[model samples]
Target chain A: MTLSPIQILVIIAAVALGTMITRFLPFFLFPDNKKRPTFVIYLGKVLPYAVIGLLVVYCLREISFSSPAGWLPEGIAILCIAILHFWRENVLLSIGVGTAVYMLLVQYVF
Target chain B: MQSDNLHSPKKPADKRIKTKALKAAFPHTIPVLTGFAFLGIAYGLLMNSKGYGVGWTLLMSLFVFAGSAQYVAITFLTSVFNPLHALLMTLIINARHLFYGIAMLDRFKNTGRLKPYLIFALCDETFSVLCAKEPPAGVEKRWFMFFVALLNHTYWVAGSVTGALLGSTLSFNTKGLDFVLTALFVVIFIDQWKQQKNHAPALIGLLCSTLALVVFGADYFVIPAMIALLAGLALYRKRAEKGETL
Candidate 1:
């Protein structure tokens, strides 16, 4: 809390401004009048799928086999999520059930 | 007669169309409500734990809107003052939004006024939700997307404000609650995996990110993972565009 209220606000505003730059920069670069390159278009098409995969891995970065919880909760939870998604084909059910399993394991078993 | 019928019944009033779009958009955002509410509350509690008040948390959620980056910003808030350093960190943390924007360029085209708001509010959850699901047939895409974006934003703000109000005064064991975010991404990944005909891009993302995480370690893995994913996709496009794998 060394920063004053105004300073904290500036920090918040700066983060907001910085994030918007990333969001809007592409639109600015590839305006309607100009043609986006084929490479850019291709990346756009395939990037979403890959990014989500990265996110899944990203979310579990803290895990290590050496840890007491080890990877049991995450491993079982992720497998459960995958299986539930494939079985039920329901996003909400998969996530809801998977998270519940993880919370249970961590709070109770782990 | 067929051609005439095509255009006639579809021309609903703008208000009616908008109401329909909002309805369609809302059901899709229910998962985001649960996810963002948890994450946002954690964020607010963290800020409250650090002595920042409810006002700051609300404003941060309102303007910044980016979830992970906002959490990182809290770390910067307590430290020594350096706007340049904070800005750079914010950009790096949010650089993923650049990829989200690129992926969304086509879908967002012709969205008019909603386009700017869409871009402004393109958090990971919003992007993932919109990217994975399209508006139901007959719903206006622009309004549908607008409502999706608006609803997610609202959930974040509300969750944070509530958490900030309660976090300082209340104490509870909320550990392991953050599993919600991981579950969310896992669900989205599964849905996207099912929706797509090809799985190479998804596998590429998973493998490269896993490698990067091992090699560069987690703290510095994201940018390199993105670069590797970009390169892998670029190489795949060569084969993909040639009709080897559609």
Candidate 2:
């Protein structure tokens, strides 16, 4: 490592501080004492669904579209998950089967 | 005298509730258990390869508690020292957390002493689990959320520590196992879609993120995606407000 121990600790502290700032800032901005603006409340209602979508995309962000094979495993697995989830509406079942399918694809099929 | 008597009975009952909440929360965290363990182990192994020991791995996983940021931190540790740059990178990577906090503002309200920890521990998986899984009837919501966060945190810390100590001893082709997290999010997205009357938000999120990804590439897409997401939602809110008023 190029960094000395103290420098490493300083970087870690800085990272930790930055992380806490992102996580904690919203609560501080819209404290319970003050009236949260309507836009903020609207965001509170809608952002969760949107954020989950964002997360799903974030997970697949590494997949390359230039090659068909690059995206195949994730594409197939997500298809299976959506199908199984809608068919059965079982959370664990869908996630378990989907992940197992993806593991099999990437490990063997792909 | 009356208040003291009331508090006395509630204390034991509170303990019972906490235990029950922990039990209820465990099943919901099973996916995260698999995901965090694999990812954390990968993280720990990376740290070990970089010559950092168990202490550094454990400390980063426990204190920073953000997976992507920690991975970025490893790069920082190996590169020329620049604390300001590290902090900026961390902030950019974790900026999505701001949205999680906004969404959780109400659900986490009235959590009392547990509020700070709940907010502190609101990592991506914890946030998703808490957002999707409401406490079962008669289970205290605050306690359930707390246990969910605590269990995920434990899995991550333990996994990293195990990896740090084990250091590539086990032999398993664990490739693609980390898809559990992706699967978890997709399932939750579906659940939210079904539960909510409006689909615009979910659609907006997917559209904006995908657009940004195409435009910005993976490394830089997140912030642009976040900005586009906020703009899309704001426009959505405006239209919905008009529809409601009319």
- Root-mean-square deviation (CA) per prediction: 4.5, 3.3
Candidate 1 residues B1-246, lDDT tens each?
345322244666766887898999999899899888778887888888889889899999999998878878988899998777788888877887888999999989977656899999999999988887889899988889999999999999999998899897899666676787888898888788778888999999999889889999868888988898888888888878798754
Per model, kept true contacts as a fraction are 0.82, 0.88
lDDT of 2 at B212: 97
On TM-score, the leading prediction is 1
Chain A only: list TM-scores of all candidates. Answer: 0.85, 0.80
lDDT of 1: 0.86
Give the alpha carbon lDDT tens digit for every residue of B1-246 in model 2.
345332354688757887899999999998788778767887787787788889989889999998878877999999888899999999998999999999999999878778999999999989988887898898988889999999999999999898778775655565776687688789888888888887888999999999999999988999999999999999987887788831
In candidate 2 chain B, what residue range of length 10 has the lowest lDDT sum?
B1-10
Q: In terms of TM-score, how similar is model 2 to the real structure?
A: 0.86
